[model samples]
Target: MCEWVNRIEYSLWTQHCDEGRRFGHMTKNISECMNSILKGVRNFPVCSLVKATYGRDNSEFTVAETTLTDSFSLGSYRVSLASQTCDCGYFQALHFPCPHALACCAYSWLTWEPYVHQLYRLNSVFSVYRMGFTPPISEGFWPPYDGPTVIPVPNKRRAREGRPTSTRIRTNMDEADPNRPKRCGLCRQPGHTRRSCPQLRGAEHTRGHD
Candidate 1:
């Protein structure tokens, strides 16, 4: 069953899916085979995992061409140089260029940097992470104060009761007699049995009525 699923995955990746993700130039299964590559790293330490992920992303940036995929930037883009419009609707929508526009510019030898917004550049990225995070100090290093420690009042505390009852408590459902009759057997009336029926004491009722 697992092998069948793997074959399906290999087919989808190599043959490409309908959602437009394809290896445009390549006609072979990826050399490393993603499942095999990732399986080994599944149990990597947290730091190693983060490092691996960051390194993987950076490696993707080195590859000039990329397949159009949902994870890339949302929608697939149509880049046309003549009209300078991208169907992704990002270039005109934000007027701040995107990867699709950059790809087009790069293809035409027309300097992609100008189209990319300055705030999205490497300098801006470097600026954001320039300051290292301040290290956390131990709790003991926190300032000491003379204020009374906030605690529950002695009277508010629950009585340290004796050992709890070992037996389970009975609920109404458990105590109810399932054998009890729905109607009185003696009177053929609702609500009680022959033993507890008021109709069974008809002579006494007659005397009271008299």
Candidate 2:
């Protein structure tokens, strides 16, 4: 029986199953592929892992011309990969590649490292720490000050403190402009307010009888 089953083709075994093609099965699991990619990275420190991932040159570069559009605003920005500039000004101002420039780099299959400022690079950060700082001298060895000592005025000191009262002097500028005309709120006419308006008085008098 085993020898006869071995003689039959594998396709003959699955001929009765109608839904076999719809299963979308893969020969290799996705997690296994990811584990293979991150094989040695598991033991790496966070910073080293990030650096390794960023510096990895496994991706193949492709030649393609493409345009990037801002989805939210539906705006087109000109990005110059060679000059490391975008029309939005963020790339130049921040010394980092902006979204538009990053999109351009991705579309062109180019590396964005060249566009980034050296100040942000790991080498620059390492260089900063390479310099040895001079040890600070003891405070007792500091030079004495010859300048006059400042004394606080007793009158200026707060007498009572909850929230300190504002000491801002009221000036003419703080008041509303006198040249501007006041309007009557009830009639929408200049000179009198709604409280003293004749129309308001008439309305009150008419409503009193009803």
Candidate 3:
């Protein structure tokens, strides 16, 4: 029965599965393979892991963010640095610049593209499951499996009983100011005519003043 199971497993692996082929549509399997590569790295020191992961040879150099021009083929939308995203789903979901944005940045000679991982990648998620494993203990440790002297923490300072006075400071106002009149929606300036606003109407003298 064990031999039969082994044969079956081998056969399954050798045979092509439709779903497995479909999984490669957007490189989903590649991400899963990367996750497996990172599995053993969880127990290692973080600085060491970073140095290893983003090492000179292994690093995937990316392009920088820059203004989109008619000359560049950026598809439908532009790269918005303020939002840290491109119009396509790439930068918004990943918090990393999309290929177009990266290309723009590279062309512009910007280096911010290298640090995008700090903004988006969740390193803590990998630590959670990796920390669950216990290290192998030395023999002759006995049933307690202990070595170091555990000390009861000494209280250095007494805990404060009362809350700070700043916490009790209260204000009478229940809502924001209501008298603040809406600014000219056109120019976004206060006390201005909407149609006459220079921004929306474009800068010009009234009727005939050159």
Q: Candidate 1, which segments miss by more than 4 Å at Cα?
A: 1-85, 92-108, 131-134, 141-182, 185-188, 191-210
> How well is each residue in 68-143 modelled by candidate 1, as lDDT tens digits?
2211332466765434457877776676656787765554446655655578788989998888999999999999
Q: Alpha carbon lDDT of residue 46, candidate 1?
A: 74
Q: Which ten residues in a row have the lowest lDDT in candidate 2?
A: 65-74
- Candidate 2 C-alpha lDDT tens digits along 52-80: 65544223112422323222121577777
Worst 10 residues of 3 by lDDT: 62-71
Instruction: Provide C-alpha RMSD values for all models, in order.
Output: 26.5, 24.2, 34.4
TM of each candidate vs. truth: 0.27, 0.35, 0.25
- Candidate 3, 116-150: lDDT as tens digits: 76634466566566766777887777476467887
Q: Report the error of model 1 at residue 71, Å.
A: 28
Give the alpha-carbon lDDT of every model.
0.62, 0.70, 0.59
Candidate number of the best TM-score = 2
